[model samples]
Target chain A: MFYVPVSSSGGDTVNTGAAITPAQYVQHHLEHLTLNLRTFRVGDLQEAQGFWVLNLDTFLVSLILGIGLVVFLRFVAVRMREVPGGLQNFVEIMVGFVDKSISEVYHGKSKLLAPMSLIIFMWVFLMNAMDLLPVDLLWRILDLFGVTYFKNVPTADPNVTFAMSLAVFFLIIFYNIKIKKFHLAKEMLTVPFGGYLFPLNLVFRLIEECVKPLSLALRLFGNMFAGELVFILIALLPWWGQGLPGGIWAIFHILVITLQAFIFMMLTVVYLSMAHDTH
Target chain B: MGINATLIGQFITFAILVWFTMKYVWPPITQAMHDREKKIAAGLEAAERSKRELEMAERKAMSIIRDAKQQATHIIDEASRHSVLLVEEAKQQAKEEGARMIELAQHEISREVTQAKEVLKTQLATLVVAGAEKVIQRHLDASAHMALLDELVAEI
Candidate 1:
């Protein structure tokens, strides 16, 4: 028989070093590669490769969230009628709310923005909801299958969130191009600093576009990662200390998770709306 | 950190989810909401009908009560008229009976008075006859008195 050592702290027994020190565990989860060694190119910025790597947790969780979103939507679709039941009713309320928000932000036509906003809300909500799951659950399951190092939350990973934001950013750019064309860009460059300073105008606009994806990704990743951290710290508490506080925190977290998802979805809709706008 | 194979998976998942939600979910949810609203409206209509029926029943009850009161008043008036007629008939009959009785009593009295007068006249004539017979008997013979009495009888 093997004995697992559980330590008592603050008058409550907690399962601690039988696994790993709190700092090491947190560090292992937090650490990211400052640079991507494989993507190294001479022309690439010197600071790029050493930049923090993608957080695996955020990516995996987001994938699950995406699937969950589809399934939920499918279920709602199956149950739709001339009259709504419980789940259908709830989904309608959510859709209506998201639709209203998009309508308010994106004015020209409801056709594109309405559907897009609904999609964003449900998808991001699904992603944010992923934080509700225990951080180690997937890892433990994977460990059973001999894979010990799987992180399950994709939104927490800077790379994945940034990638998602960048996709939206690119779509925005594409729409702007489609709406305004080359003339639109020329006009924009000529407006603020005048056509004479075209170089600076172009440079500034490029920087602005680049920052959109970065901000979008960082915002989502930061909020979700913080929530995850809170949960982890709660889990580290002993018996009454850990269990009670963890329960309390988990309850509060339900709102945080849902809110974060909603914010992310709404922002996406706003960005898309802005992209479609003319001036 | 790097653009690895995972990015492909992520993009694929996003596309699939968006497609599924658009195709499978939105139409039905909208339909269900509409149906629920219709059902609620129907229920309200049903409630309104029942309310109208209740009002009609209430009106019917009031009419029935009004009719009963009217019938009762009519009966009372009829009863009063019949009683008056009965009393009037009885009084007329009583007056006729009294008149008849008085008439009969007057006739009897008249008859009695006439008979008495006749008796008295007869008595006075007999007395005068007796006195004349006495005088004639004294002055003449019995045969003469008889002859006189015979003549008197023939004349009457």
Candidate 2:
């Protein structure tokens, strides 16, 4: 149900040079640059229906930004001064903020939490912040190079968000197993209801476990995707008309981006902490 | 878009990022932050220690000044007592010197008086002898005059 096409109803109007309808414009912006990697034949890549088709644009943008984030952070880390200034100060502040949040929420000593939280927060933030860029600007640039179907905001994609949340989900399960040991299976079959209701308890436990990553991924995905949609929708207006609403939405989106990133990081910490909790 | 291999690719990317960050990006920054925090705490502790040491030094200086003042007063008191003893000794020596001079002068005056008495006695005995000689020439003798002189000297 969550996999339904988010693009509005519109037929492809490319090569016609005719002004695209609002639906077609939104659809064009919604399309991802994809590559089909299936060994056997499947639906076309343009349809995004193949199970093995990769969203090239999503991976490219996310990979580039991820590398940029690491490089920038490494630069700051390498040259970090006792008296921090500029980029180093900014990076340190972010690092400190993430560390403090994880320490506060995640009481158990997992060496991975702080760094993981930092990566997710910063990566998600950078991806979301890409929405603030003028949507038409990148499209026009790509159009100049004879390219279309590029979505720059990686977090807007459910796949990317799901990938991150799934990673976190695995960590939660791993921690549960590590911390609870043999008791985890017992608790899953017993808790909230008694052992007598083991079957119902297992179902509920599965749902509970599924909900953590689902909510985490969907929350960020929904917010960024909506924000990106709004930008594309605003871009559909006359150039002059786009200014006021676009500017207003962009300003409001700053809050959305930061909040979504924070929510994602907070949930990751909370879930991992819950996993570490006994019974 | 439909779910695709991008999900797996993204998962790979995420894993790589997590691994890279955990290995390289996260540690140094956090370490720098921790190092800075420790440095700040050490600096604050040092400041507190120096402040305590300064207060102690001031207290020590005050005590030392008080001790020096007490020592100076003690030295002055001792000097005054020594001066008083020296004045008393000088006065006693002067009194003894004055008594000795007076006694020597009295003795000399008595000696002079005795000499003058002896000369007068000589002159009187000569006159008496001359008169006795004249008288003896008319009435008495020299032996009797000598016995009279001896008795007169013994009476003086």
Q: What lDDT does candidate 1 reach at residue A191?
A: 56
- Candidate 1, which CAPRI tier? incorrect
In candidate 1, which residue ranges exceed 4 Å CA deviation?
A: A1-19, A30-61, A110-112, B1-3, B31-156
Per-residue lDDT of B37 in model 1: 75
- Model 1 CA lDDT for position A276: 73
Every model's TM-score = 0.60, 0.86
The C-alpha stretches of model 2 lying farther than 4 A from their native spots are: A1-11, A38-47, B116-156
Expressed as tens digits, the lDDT of each residue in B31-128 for candidate 1 is: 66667778999999999999999999999999999999999999999999999999999999999999999999999999999898778668756865
Q: Poorest 10 consecutive residues of model 2 chain A by lDDT?
A: A1-10
**Clash pairs detected, candidate 2:** B136-B140
Best by TM-score: 2
- Tens digits of per-residue lDDT for model 2 on A141-206? 765554556788999999999999999999999999999999998999899899999999999999
Q: Per-residue lDDT for A184-269 in model 1, tens only?
A: 77756875699899888888878877888778878878887888788767656664676677777778878877777677777777
